[model samples]
Target: MILASLLRPLRSFRCVLLFSILIRIGLIIYSEWHDSRSVVKYTDIDYRVFSDAAHFLLNPGPENENVAQGPLKSLLGWKISLGNPYTRETYRYTPLLALLVSPNDWSHPSFGKYLFALCDIVNGILIYKLLVNVILPSSSHNAASQPPNKTEKHASGPQHKRDELSRTEIEALATTFSAIHLLNPMVFSISTRGSSESVLSLFVLMTLYASLTKRWDAAAIMLGVSTHWKIYPVVYGVACVSALSGGSVGSTSWHLSLVNQKTIRFALLSAFTFGILNVVCFLIWGHPFLEETYLYHLHRLDHRHNFSPYFYFTYLTYPPLVKQPLDSESLSSWNQLMRSPLTSFVPQMTLALGAGLYYGHRIDDLPFAWFVQTVVFVNFNKVCTSQYFLWYLLLLPLILPRFHVSRRQAFTYVGVWIALQAFWLGEAYRLEFLGEDVFLSLWMRGLVYVLGNCWVLVELMKAYS
Candidate 1:
């Protein structure tokens, strides 16, 4: 009878594995189909910008006009003036990212797209591992806490616990989450488009996983590598520091114990190793590469339509803001108008530091720390894009395991996002009347932007209290 019972589960497992493989195959087919067409083109402003950087990297030029673009181009190889018909005069925004896009035969546009898709696949795998091995462990513990059934009781005790998850059961759960990550529309869209979000997310997940295992050195190195990719990852470092400190505000046992000599030593060592690695990378790559990746992003004043609260308010009061096209010269004026007193460059830094210190004091509870830091970072940023949504998406599952919300509520939240995504696509595509009606499109996009983040803030407040 026991053999029959086990055989039934094995059959179910094989069925699930077959189903998963089919779904993955379907997704790959869809991705390839989408890549073949230029059916949707949104000016390709960012793509053109990055492509120019790639060109400059492959061919270095005089510093007179090129110096202002930033130092990242040097990393691609000493710039040569390849006076090719394809070379257009434009500045590259992201040099390191551009390097990845550059290929020996600069003719193929799909090279970078394929590379990003691969990163996206890797990201899905990492997230699956994190969920199954780390986050789901807590969920399983909660499940085990419930009273066992009569059959379970008969076979209960430590032996039953061991049987609860065989190697196959564990692998199934991992595979399920991995499939979910890959199918997620957000992941699929970004991966095929050559955006930096997939790469940044992979690094963030690695850093989080390392922290969860209490491997300070590995976590710190991951954090540094993430920042090297994009500045936004730095906010996660604050989250990590806060997590290392333990719980919300208070003098708990975890907080009290953090002051020990051994803890302090590990913390300092991690920080030193992270700092040195970043510094060395910056020096080897040169200041221009570091500046393009880190500093140039700081000076970006491009207010070319985003879905943040600032965009919504500006559109509501001054509809002209949406109509005005962005230009290099007008950037300074736009920055001056949209800039907030509290979130000024200096004040924002202060707030980040303050939040870091407060969270660091209570480091034992990393999830809560990550939640708070994500809230602060998103709320304070000047512009919020659809891709930025992944930051919250990645962190939400981690936080969800620690807190309980009704299944209905979870579904409702996800449903709202799906509706918003529809609106976002309509706006991006400028579909029919929707595209012509600039105010309506802007409002729809802006609403999604605000509500999505508002939900996160509400969740964070609950976690804090």
Candidate 2:
């Protein structure tokens, strides 16, 4: 029975992977011709930095003991610039990313796209596996990603078995999820653009999948790697620790629960992995690794081309009153503190923690909780961008069937969300390119978009029981 069950999924995965690969290859080839003919290229400029960083690491001028396989020079502080790290020439992300892309051949510049494209495909497979392993055994089939209840797990009657998804139903759900992810235009193009968002999605889902299977050590490793790659996934730490405790939050005080042995085990392992990575890289790259990767993102201030509702407000407080560490001293004056862009982070974190606690308190709730958490995090962040949406987009497929909304309602909500973004894009185009004074108008649109997002969230909550 086990062998048959396993083979069925393997066959299903192979079919979907082949189809996804063909579609991506076609789009990538078309992009090569299409990009060259247009004013704007389909390949993002960020791709240049990723590819170049790889080649730079392959050979860094003989600084470390003349080691021939000398990627040790990759750690030199002077090799990459942290000042104005925003440019395509300078690498602003993790050293691990450089190593990941180091094997790509510069002879074929699109190699990074191909590499990220594979990550996108593998993410789809992980989504399928996640659905199959996690199940609310007694709930309706629509609730695809949740652990079986204790009663359901112990039950031996035919009714208990009947509640479980059959091979056919599970296969159907897997197909739908894989198709949703691989075929989504935004998700597809993210890889083609060569943004590492797909890679991030891979690690994030791997962590979630590992946790769902109760693979604590593996989950901790993946969570650590994901967090190190980009700091945002650290927020999911709350959800993970809570889920691992198995609704133990009620039996123990909050502090005690946080200090629970399970929590400590996961935390220490994850932190150790994170620390070892930084320490090894810091030895070579020096302080810039810490400053550029972590610090810069914490207080990042970019008002232009921003979609956050705080965009106009941040613009008003553009040049910060003072450049200082994020300490109580910097927040001494109410006037300065209230006006700072970082003030928006208060609500961003509050909503994220609230969502994480309410929804991520149990294994059954983790999948949807993660989706909600990511959406809330991205929506209210001081710096919001389209690419950030992919954080949730990867998990969006898992909980899609759990919602009870009609097709019409789903279309209405999605259409409104897309329409609001389109409206903002039009206003931004006029302000940036047409050089119109549309700041106030853009702010108004942004406010309405924020309200629209709220409405969608409320409707989703109501429909997802």
Candidate 3:
């Protein structure tokens, strides 16, 4: 009864949403104040790009406006030139993003920031729903099938009823889900800085929620729209389709049939929706939309701020005319496994597809499936940035409660993760800011960071699955 009393108020989502709003208001004020005092503003550059694109679209000017420029060339033998398609880092997403934030130009400057914060809160609310509708139900089903405990065998009334979670406990867990997403440092900072990831995250969860509830069309359309908005979520369509085609946990198995009606329908509808969006964008933005938004990302090569395991290779293979902070004669002795750019694509796709098929085979594990798939995709990606981490972080909390890791084990993994990151950042700082030749050292640290990530992934699999 004491525990129940403590949890009762937490179940009130209305109160939770109110608290989130108040916190966002405070964050907005704090961010604006901080930016006013700083040399560089706290607002993300993407926000500026979005505003510029909107201004250009709303009222055409006689001059040419260059948004982003990609002059990167291939590292080794392949002369993969991105050829100054964009002049600077401008709006590189769908024109609809500019449309969403265009109101900021005429209205308040922080209009888009407010929109993203609201979406962040909505992402929290969706996680709460996912916990209630999908995760908790599976836990309860598993509990019911197991043998009863001493409390269940000896007690009367509610205690003996399947030994399931009470309404109060479920509500508390849902509120916990909200807390994890809304209050997380990484997630909170990204949304407050005016990135559209919060918006993208909302659609990802919406697609999952819609699919688990057996709303096929809603799921398909949601998936399509999110993919159009940002390309990463398209990988999740595989997991959703896998979950739909498979059966319950114990009886889950793979089979092939021409008339597996549900998956076929889902696939066709999603493709149609995506194709329609592409056609519409093509008419509006011409070939530039296809080139800049989609193809640019595919052939993206970040040689300067590179973070992948292939970073050193990317750096070493730069054209001889390009100046390096330090000559890497020692580094030249190491063999290059990849002679060309885009070599990582095969391994990335293979692992991602394998994870989708394996975890999505069990409907009960769909959240885990998406989380693992995103982690693999981001880790192996050719160009990884700070924001890309949010892709998997959005799905992490849904499966966290089930992880069997003890506090000590969890802390150890977290400490190693943070330590490795600090080491990489420190080494990178020495090379970039101090004009030191720490490139080789930074590359070695980058390899260690990738190893650290793999360790965490293995631990997560053992703890949760």
Candidate 4:
């Protein structure tokens, strides 16, 4: 009776949250069973990488001794034999994963699946809070034009409307976030599939929540940690600094004083926190650590299972090359350009810089602008993994509610995006699993992905502009 009374406040969502948890638990059990039986484990590649690193850290050998020295040693013409700790293998994740999993019996296959599921739950709850608090309130201004009852009449001014979400609004917002994060099949598939994207998404949500609450130092610190987990969150650091500056949201007027002492203080703290962790990693594992964790990502361009828009370029130039193994040393100079570090680096930088500057200037609405900037950053990323979709998916509840779109328009927009994803995945399935040499179709799918992203961006502009 007491539990029922307490859950009555959450109303329908109490059941929803419980059901979501059950669904995730079921998925985890199924995945564990599948892993035990299947000869070719699907998500085993990434899980093995993390678990191997953890085991290595827990039990080092003579092979781990030849840690590479600084690049300056090579520049100074010193004979430095960089040990291939992971000669045919690579652990591209940060040491934080190794640290977290090493002590917790990560040797077991179920540990990662369980950890990811827990993080997925955390993400759902965080998204719910963000919606009920930050986003719904910012959107209430449009509703403010309507007549408020006696209760709302006594309500505080526009800035503080966030403090007063009605029961119905709260229920609706809770339902939306819970349904999106908890009930979405994509979330289930990713978590059960043993992707660490769930953990990354949780940190991203926490960082967003802190920024929304104007906890500058807290937001900065979280962003730094999240970036350490995965390099992509570094892009959101710009949004963090912008939010801390505390200018009016959605405004074009730029403030020279925006770059003030408080901003600098927070920025420095964030940098120090971020730099210290990476430095410690270097000290512990030496140059090989940095190379695998950081450099490997920049250099990775797999034509085999690549779903990036750049794949189209590779297809057009060398259709046959898609089937070849990833022997970087054997590639010709022109073929190397197809997977060149410069190719992805320059464009990603340009887009991120432009988006950061544009949205950073307009601070009429920090949360919304942050969402736009984040989506823009991901849209422009060189390597768009399917799982990376969660980075923006978790934020959509906040943005979509605020967007003044018609029901039909919203449905159409979502349908188009899903269709694009489905088309790409279908092609990928044919090639990767069925052994179909549908290289040309894969190129078409990449083009469709690009177009779909462009459409989404256009709609975002319409909503904000």
TM-score of each: 0.67, 0.82, 0.83, 0.80
Model 1 stretches astray by more than 4 angstroms: 1-51, 61-94, 104-108, 142-171, 246-248, 252-291, 312-337, 340-368, 419-452, 456-465
Collision pairs in model 2:
75-284, 75-285, 135-146
Q: Give the root-mean-square deviation of each candidate in angstroms.
A: 7.7, 7.1, 7.6, 6.6
Which model scores highest in TM-score?
Answer: 3
TM-score quality measure for candidate 4: 0.80
- Stretch of 10 with least lDDT, candidate 2: 80-89
Error of 4 at 230 (Å): 0.9
Clashes counted in candidate 2 amount to: 3
TM-score: the better of candidates 1 and 2 = 2
TM-score between model 1 and native: 0.67
lDDT of 4 by residue, 1-465 (tens): 999786554456667678778888888787767778998664647776766666655554463354344443445654444332343266777767765666434356568778888888887778777766666665565555455444443332232243456758665766655677787898878877777888888888787778778787887888888887787777766755665566654556545545878779877887887898888667555677687888877756555555576766655455435456546566676777776677876777666655665565433355555566666666556567776777777776656555555556667888888898888888889998899988878867877787787887778667552
How many pairs of residues collide in model 4? 9
Better of 3 and 4 by TM-score: 3
* Residues 1-465 of candidate 3: C-alpha lDDT, one tens digit per residue: 999887566567777677677888787778889888998888888877777676665654332343211112112233321122223255578767777877887887788889999999888888888887777766766755667665444332221347577777776776776677776878777777888898888888888888777788999998998999988778877777778776543442454521278888988888898888887666455566787789877655457655688777767765432233233453343323332334877777788877886678666677889899998888887777668888988987788756655567778888987787897899899998999988888989888888888889988898663
Candidate maximizing lDDT: 2
* Ranking of predictions according to lDDT: 2, 3, 4, 1
Point out the higher-scoring one by TM-score: 1 or 3. 3
